[model samples]
Target: MAGALLGALLLLELLGGGDGKNEELRLYHHLFDNYDPERRPVKEPEDTVTVTLKVTLTNLISLNEKEETLTTSVWIGVDWQDYRLNFSKDDFGGIETLRVPSELVWLPEIVLENNIDGQFGVAYDANVLVYEGGYLSWLPPAIYRSSCAVEVTYFPFDWQNCSLVFRSQTYNAGEVEFVFGVDEEGETISNIDIDTEAYTENGEWAIDFCPGLIHHHGGSADDPGGIDVVYTLIIRRKPLFYTINIIVPCVLISGLVLLAYFLPAQAGGQKCTVSINVLLAQTVFLFLIAQKTPETSLSVPMLGRYLIFVMVVATIIVVNCVIVLNLSLRTPTTHAASPRLRHVLLELLPRLLGSRAPPEPPRAASPPRRASSVGLLLRAEELILKKPRSELVFEGQRHRHGPWTAALCQSLGAAAPEVRCCVDAVNFVAESTRDQEASGEEVSDWVRMGKALDNVCFWAALVLFGVGSSLIFLGGYFNQVPELPYPPCM
Candidate 1:
């Protein structure tokens, strides 16, 4: 009976332990809290990602006072996921809040761990919800309680050398490790890299710890939080290809064009051709540039601007050619100049200006034609001499005149009397020319006119080349700063 009584007491003790609190704990195992059915979809797998990355930087906002929050923005790569987050005013030490879209959030299974301290930590607010999805099976948010300490090794006391930096570490999981690369199942994440390294570290010193937003995504048990990451804050200037490729080349080419003045126009088409050829070569390079770059409707690139300028200059050159040709065509008399102005201008001016005298002219424009005509006439005269004097005369002369008279006429005609007529004409022309020369110092006005025209052509071509090049080179002074102080989409 005492044993039974002890058993009953033992059963009662067990019954008492099963109370409301215990039942509540048991039920909680199957139930969930803080359920968000409307949570955002995960971000990843987009051909192009667009982000409004604003990196606000402030330096020693009054060094006497304690350093406050300084906010900034930056864009991650396009391949990564994009996330939009809001930052509060007190976040960067006490500057304005910056709203930014982080392109890095687009990657697969990223985990973000925040460990900030004090009221500054409370003031800092970041939203890391999903923005888009190319993958499924995303893990729910997890809160891990831990203290964070950030020790900046070489924090710049002055804002002059400060910059924002974003560092990333990527990992893969069990099954993923076997198939592709960077064994994700391993403890250390593979392929952790900084995307902006190409632009920020080329021998320039800067200081600005611009705070950036961090984004992360995690997978479920089937997918299993395969990646971990860490990010560092850095500040830097965006890459500016316009300054290097476009502005520099345009300036250089323009300077070369301005040198056109140094080339003599009488150099015969070479000066003009050189300028045009340079412009043409630039155009070819421009074509190559266009082919290799992405097509965008956004503002044109600096290189494109340079190309347009060169093409315009090339057109101007064509116009200058017309002008030079016109000058060369000008005559000493009113619109009566022959094409010989090219030679006359090339010749007379240098000699007139105390340079060497002009080259002598060819005896005639074409020597063969004159020689052929003269040879024919001489052959006909020889044939006439071989014939009898009677046969050479008119038909009636043989019957109407005596043989003696005919003989006399033939002797006079054949004995070079006709040659004297040509000689007389030549002598008359020589005397008239000689008299003109004696009166006016023997100068050909045509030759003088040509020289003056060549000088005009040379100067005109030079001016056109100079003006066009100058406008393009000086154009940099007229450029306005970009509306967004960041790099554009590739």
Candidate 2:
């Protein structure tokens, strides 16, 4: 009798515990038995369901300026009152909150309207939290790739105002109302909330501000189009990456352009080589900037403009180098230095540029008076011919050697014409040599002028580079991001 009584009490305890455990299962059946998930959880058909929305940014994936897209990781919190899901906690064994699959309930179905990809909904269909008093909250994580207009006016030093527009596809403004989520203080939140603890910072871009606003479009009593929530994510480029990789290197290379003019006129090849290299470097930088920016003809980036200026200067330097080389290599035979050009490049320009023409080579000293071989030969011939044959005699002998004297006179006279011809040839050669030396002096003047011109050009290029660089980049230096993410009227 005692064993039977103990067994009966134990069975009763087990039955009670089992019943308590099945309460959640029974609640699920009771709540969803007649629940029409298709119908809006409103009392009347005309009654509007207001959904509160809040976005928590998890990470900034990337912003593609060329593609005009913004990719981000975010969590969207949507809360609303679902009257059909209400339940009595006391009847369900003190259960207050229940988690149910999102497919079993009505959803606001807010989707990104400005999506670059064709897909519109969130990334996943998550669970919904149901409270006893008909309050439902759903937090879905999504990776949104939305369209954003990129303004590359400032470029790497630029700030952008991108937006994520969310709207309901099934419901119009009259059927569904959208409102911003409020904080614990009951104040409406105007900006996106950053998940600071979980947020990963972007290396290239920094968040300036992100403002959320509710905008209604084409909604009237007869025709209600829709309402959208615009989350404007204003971001400014960090600029450090571009400054190190693009801007600084470009500036240093552009500074090398001025060195071309400082090179001597004789080093024209070196000057041309440097100018071409600088131009090519600027072209490469321009190409890089083009790849980074959108392909638009509306405006050019500041850095690109500066690069173009540098290239133009480099081209001019190359042309000037050619001219300087031509001047240095000029000869009196081919290109004579005109009096005006000589005065400007050698005299006037040099004085104005605080320079002087190179000194001419010293003239060679005249040799001491000496008789030429031809002249000596001709003098000996004339002295022999001047004396008569009868008087011709050796100093040691006193005989009138008429026949031998006649023979010597004949030989000397015969060689006289050949000696005279040699003398005339020597005089002609001397005159030609003197003319060549004078021509060489004239050639030296042109080279000096070329050197003086190089000085003038060096200073001119320096001034132009300084002023042009300052003008082109000064605006970017002063560019400042606005405090507000978007315009106040927006």
Which candidate wins on TM-score? Answer: 2
Per candidate, the number of residue pairs that clash is 30, 0
TM-score of 2: 0.80
For candidate 2, write residues 374-480 as lDDT tens digits. 35445456656775322222210112235576465445545565644554567678889999988888887877888887777788888999999898778787787
Model 2 poorest 10 in a row by lDDT:
390-399
lDDT (Cα) of model 1:
0.39
Top of the candidates by lDDT: 2
Candidate 2 collision pairs: none
**Predicted candidate 2, C-alpha RMSD:** 9.0
Q: What is the TM-score of each candidate against the true structure?
A: 0.33, 0.80
Clashes of 1: 30
What lDDT score belongs to each candidate, Candidate 1 first?
0.39, 0.82
